[model samples]
Target chain A: MERTTIDLWVGVFVAMGIAALLFLALKVGNIGGFEAGSVYTTHANFDNIGGLKAKAPVKSAGVLVGRVTEIRFDNDSYQAEAILSLSSQ
Target chain B: MGVSTRFFFLLLLHSGTCFRRPQLILREIFSSGVLSLIIILVSGLFVGMVLGMQGYETLQTYGSEEALGVLVSLSLVRELGPVVAALLFASRAGSAITAEIGLMKATEQLAAMEMMAVDPLARVVAPRFWGGVISMPLLAAMFSAMGIFGGYLVGVVLIGVDEGSFWSQMQAAVDIREDILNGVIKSTVFGIAVTVIALFEGYDAPPTAEGVSRATTRTVVTSSLAILMLDFVLTAFMFRGV
Candidate 1:
């Protein structure tokens, strides 16, 4: 086989491998490329907090506006705080 | 044992030149990695589909069939993807490399290379070694991606699971750095263990027909065992807290 053909095949093989990794990262894992957009960070203090988990969808009028970034127990106030990272549209 | 250890060190020392010029390694990758692509992909799809069906069956009782994506992706990425891919790679590529090198040895090509003042370890072994190492993680990743897609097809399309919930659960569970990257690391280690053992067995085979055949068989059997053992050790270290 010519050297160029070998190089081409190897290039294709490597590209496929990289594409698979990207698919795993982006499609499967939900890890997107770095975003520098501003995110509105706010906290909501709920009495019960229910079964709220981190990364749970924070909905506004049944629309997903942001994600619940962290859920914390406030010892001082004896309340639950949900830190929401709202994407700025 | 001592000879194999020495061979391993010698191969490593000669590996610097293997990467300096990429042609040889590229050729090796073509033979091992490119050839194994179809097997990896087809097997991944079937495994994922089976996992989807079985997981749906079990999770259905709990009324949590939506978690099928989670079960499929987590299992594929964390365990099945790397372990099974390496096993296939060992049987497919590892045995082939052993046979090629073992036959070359039986034909006295290695001795001729030495007589011509060329180091067979450098000229022959290192490229295949690094080639298998390079192919392993990529093949594993491709296997996992194909598996997840298969799961999606089975779960959302065929089984009528909600598409939104299926993907969301998967994305939520399959962390790239934690789950996916660790699996890549595991496969890379398995790749190293497999290729090194294959090369050693082939290089050390007695220069006879039966010896070459036995070495080829040993490559498949030993490397498969090595892959499983290494997978256990790696999983213990990587997934300890999780």
Candidate 2:
């Protein structure tokens, strides 16, 4: 009886640990940036994006609408080009 | 010096053989791990609550209170979760392991086992070592989970940070492979270091009551220092690109 009880508690402990890993992978990490459907890519030219980097969230009125997929400099136009991928949502 | 070196080698040798008995390892895991788990869970909760409160106040100043979840979860998952849990493990479980083994040594139980041709290192120390190593990562994970829940309680339920934004922002910001996995790796390294130090100190302690107490104290102190030192090195390596 005692052995089974201990086993039960240990099993719960291990389950909780696995649950935390799952949370990390799914919620916090979001794993491979999984999104439903497809994302729409839009290009915009900017004078300077400052410290903006790829994968930065694109927010509209304090709501996250999309992500910056890529950033590059257009030397001919002397402007920064940012590629944004907006979720279908 | 020669005797101590030989003893170290014996510990290394028996560590391999100790896994043969699953029952004994399970018993040691119960004795050495459960208390640490309880302590770490409570600590993690409180830490997260405090973080939620503090983050809300600070971010609210900048009109960014919705980011509380990101702040709390990222902090706990990336750094505080593994590091603080390991420290708690060192103080609670690590000290206990040292004291238990040290007491056994002081009472000449180890000597008796040796005289009977039983390898004390294998029978006594190795199981405890493995028990601790197995426990640390699990304990750290539980700590981070409870911490995230605590943050949710404080930020969403209490302070009224937009529940959706808190979780969604956190999910968007944190990376599993980069942050969480690295945290696990950190805790695992700390587990090995803390347990190895605890077992070594206990096994090498002078067979006296005072000696046992000193060894227990050494286990806590050395484990804390090692955890912090190793955290820095691991962080530098893991976050090198970022």
TM-score of each: 0.89, 0.85
lDDT digits (tens) for residues B167-211 of candidate 1: 877876777778888989998998998899899988989989899
Query: Candidate 2 residues B25-114, lDDT tens each?
Result: 776677767756778889999999999999999999999998898999889988999999999999988898889888988898999999
**What ranges in model 2 sit over 4 Å off?**
A32-89, B1-12
Candidate 1 deviant stretches above 4 angstroms: A33-36, A40-84, B1-3, B240-242
C-alpha DockQ for predicted model 2: 0.49
- The lDDT per prediction is 0.88, 0.84
What lDDT is reached at residue B33 by model 1? 94
DockQ of each: 0.57, 0.49
Report how far residue A2 has shifted in candidate 1, in Å: 3.8
